[model samples]
Target: MANMSMTKTPIAEQDPKVRARNFKEVTLGYTAEQAVEEAKRCLNCKHRPCMSGCPVSVRIPEFIAQVAEGNFEEAYKIIKDTNALPAVCGRVCPQENQCEGKCVRGIKGEPVGIGRLERFCADYMADKPMNIEKPEPNGHKVAVVGAGPSSLTAAGDLAKLGYDVTVYEAFHTAGGVLMYGIPEFRLPKSIVQHEIDNLTAMGVKIMTNMVIGKVLSIDELIEMGNEAIFIGSGAGLPRFMGIEGEGLVGVYSANEYLTRINLMKAYLEDYDTPIMKSENVAVVGGGNVAMDAARSAMRLGAKKVYVVYRRSMDELPARKEEVHHAQEEGIEFLVLNNPVRIIGDENGRVCAMECVKMELGEPDASGRRRPVEIKGSEFTLEIDTAIMSIGTSPNPLIRSTTPGLSANDHGCLIVDENESTTKEGVYAGGDAVTGAATVILAMGAGKRAAAAIDKYIKSK
Candidate 1:
């Protein structure tokens, strides 16, 4: 009999009060029994609308059915066939808006715990190691710039096709944003390393601290016997509101803040990285990045963290799960307000934030209700630190350096439907082409580009 419960099985988590004070992972994954119970909730719709919503098109029903029968290992393999980073995606992917959003069971009740079940299978496989055979090299050298999700996916796929793949990363370590952008409490660094390790086991060569446009040019890579090159150098340029007091000492872009806390290990007592110890912090934005900044501030010992958003709760662009987690962690929401200026102290550090009240108006370009400032409704909140988490554009290093490369008005790389750039023998995708986007979307771009590169090489 089908379980008709309106609510899905609840995954255990750390107490909000306790977790807010520590950097440990919050959600404890489901047990074997719980995984089976949750898997049973899937009605196994014949149409499989859930698969359509996924960027990489994971086999949803097949994997869930395997889990329901307790074939955990088989489930992991099914997910792995399409997704390169199931563990990371299982945790960070916005399934509520993607796969689970189109679930048939979600029509009346909560959707089957798809993310949780996926997490279970991934975690299960990690606990028990698997042996992988190295693919015989195809003698064609492929150079992949940026050791991020997109490049990693491209490299993995190319390697599987027997191509001699070389991944060049600008940072000292690989994993790009996965290494520096996301916090460990959300997606652990260990999991990321494990995924990278798998690529190495498959004979993928990684070169770290190698900046492509500076240290090596597209011509240099091609001259070194590389038949093709893939660019996935993600968007690292941070955007800020052109307001006064933004250059204050305590003010930081969410990129820098997250990089320090997550990448530099400032959260660890042993690390001597300098970070502002603020009593109160204000994160200015409404997206998932803003929520991450606010929640990270709380974990870093800020007594109070406020999210200052221009739009109302209904229009919040962040994933609902993230918004809920932020609320549980005691983050104060200053909705329907936008920051006008940052008030700084004598030391040139942030002290307060001046904001104006906002009212929802007619739908704008993005289609959500636009926020209109109310005159004479300016207010001020006392804060010691400020973080701007608006958004980001692609870094201009590669575009400015490459002669024939083309980019749009936003500075993001201009690519065809097949992820090919204007430059011959060069392709680009992920944040370099789409600005900031989800991990799964980036992976899909990489996979598609790999196929196109393969076809191009074969024709030659």
Candidate 2:
């Protein structure tokens, strides 16, 4: 029987007050009964528009049908057929803009909790060992740069295809942004490790602390018997506003701040990583990264955290859930405000930030209203620390070192429709190809590159 309820089954979550203080997961996954009810809400549309919205094109309707029938294992298998990182994607992917957006139920009511159902299915099978038959080696070697969502997906796909796949990561840890950028309060490290373990189980070898452009070059990897290479290095280089006081003592980029707190485990008393303990913190940006930074600052004992954006609240680039969570945690939103410069104190530490009020103008290239600054509307925000979460670009190391690997002005690698780079037998994807983007999009690029690499290698 189709569930015609106007609202989908609600998943339980930690209280805002309680979750705001800890680094634990916010949303508790759906129970078996709840999963079934949610799955029942899926009309199982014949067109399967949800799959079209997905990057890797997971078999959505089939999985939902399996879930509805209480066949959790079968549902997992169906999703894993295309998606390599279901657990990660379920937690972090913006389903509202993708799968759930195209959901038929969303036309009249809330979408069938697709993300929540995916999370439920993943968590249900987390303890059970997957019964996977490792494919026979095809004798071709493929090197993947960066052990991020893209690289991991590419490696997993290639490994399953019987290619000798090895992923090289610059960080000491293997899970790239998953380990360093996202906070545990949203995406747990254990879940990420579990997914990586699944990939390794499929014969994907991961080498950490192996900086590709430095430790080994693309030419060197090719010479060392790597028949093909896929670069998913990701965009790690932080962008600044080129304003004053950026070099001050208490000012940090969102990348560095999140990296220290998440990757270095600074929040844990056991970890020796040093982080700034501030009374007032301002995160400059309105994107998801900005939300992560602001929320993280609150958990880190900041008395007050402000998300300072140049646009209105409606134009915030962050997920609505994230913004709501931040608000519930008492993080202030200083919308329609743009920072002009950071103010430093006598000792060269951030003490305040100078900002200008902004008003919306005509639509810009991004289709969002352009923020025009108001003259004589400059104001100052008193703060001890400032975290810039403006954006990030791909690092120039790989492009500078690897000849013929072309990149755009933003340092994003140029790739063809098939994800093949100008350098033959070499390919790039993920944030390395498209500037900073969603995890699912990066995974999609990896999946495509893996298929292309497989075809390229087999043709030789």
Candidate 3:
């Protein structure tokens, strides 16, 4: 640890009870002083195993050195060289499992705060003028489907290469799941919009309200002057546990429920859109999305919010910080319980949900212990609302229209190491390729696909 300065740990965030009542960002960003101090904790190892966990491979040590020296511009340059969306990554990336996971300092003490430093540098440069390089025009046009993280990264990279990229987003706004799927408390809409604006500044054309497979097919993209097409349309289909009373009123897929509130701004007092209400709400799942939905429901004025999961607290898959915040906001946790049926009232409105106690069985193929219900341990609890956050797969629209676009049994599009689809000049990646995954993994897919598209266009 020679020549390395120790950094102070970040202080605890604001009380969740007070913060959850509003739409403000949950984790306040690090101050300039705090960021620089945290930067010093890096040992600047020669091998730099931390970079190995990074998807896009930002120069971890170099950036830390710059921040340690108080050279903010140099630090940002090191990050922006590869990562196109640092601001978003800083806030949402799972550093604990990724970059920080491989840190040498983590052998004994805490690891260097690479995620926080990346976020700080990105935000610092965001206020100043953008200085990203614009590659010489390649004179080829590419059609990018979806505006989620994958497509955003691909489009940004393709735009820099001067490919005349146009992102087609089905939603009114440019961000796909980022705009609708994620709640404002986790990722602020303004920050996402600002990042999109940066891409536009780089000459990336974005077309909103344009559903690709429906409005135009894969064939149309090539026919309409686009030499190559990149499908990054993320998993839009929500999975529901097919049980009784699923059709009951007030039951919602987490996607539909969050979109109704986040993208549509249904919670705004003067907003035109409206959302259903209930005194007690139940969100089924143990992931971060479940936490987001339950917390959001509480903000919408629900008297009580409950997280229903089949696993124990230790096995819950949500981020530790998110779990801590949810508890602070007064959200209740119903662990080791599985929903059997969603019961409804005489009017077909959701009134209660039947649950069964579960015991952890042997590990399943997915590696997590499977939940086996204890027979005769069923119980019913009255509830006004139920939200399902199991998971989602890519929509069938693209696969339906684009012949020869190979997909597996799960309906997720199949792509190779380079992200080229079965089609000659088409490439697909992100959640569309792998099922729902982290933002960084999807971003890596996008970066890889951009090169594939560029090479295909050159060959043509």
Q: Residue 92 of candidate 1: its Cα lDDT?
A: 89
Computed on alpha carbons, the lDDT of every model, listed in order, comes to: 0.93, 0.92, 0.88
Runs of candidate 1 with Cα error greater than 4 angstroms are none
Q: Residue 121 in candidate 3 has what lDDT? A: 89
Q: What ranking of all candidate models by lDDT puts the best one first?
A: 1, 2, 3
Q: How well is each residue in 244-342 modelled by candidate 2, as lDDT tens digits?
A: 889999999999999999999999999999999899999999999999999999999999999999999999988888998899999999999999999
Give TM per candidate.
0.99, 0.99, 0.96
Worst-scoring 10-residue span by lDDT in model 2 = 129-138
Query: Which residue pairs clash in candidate 3?
Result: none
**Candidate 1, residues 261-304: lDDT per residue as tens digits?**
99899999999999998899999998888988898999999999
What stretches of model 2 exceed 4 Å from their correct place?
A: none
Tens-digit per-residue lDDT, 1-460, candidate 3: 2335444348446567778788778887777878777887888899999999999999999999998888999999889889988888988888988999899888777788888889888878877977656667878899999999999999999998888999998889988777897888888888899889989888899999898889998998889999989999999899999999889999999989999989999889889886887789999998878988999999898888999999899898887778888998999999999999999889999999999999999999989898999999999878999999888888988999998898999999988899999988899989999988888899999999998888878876
**Which scores higher on lDDT, 2 or 3?**
2
Clashes of each: 0, 0, 0
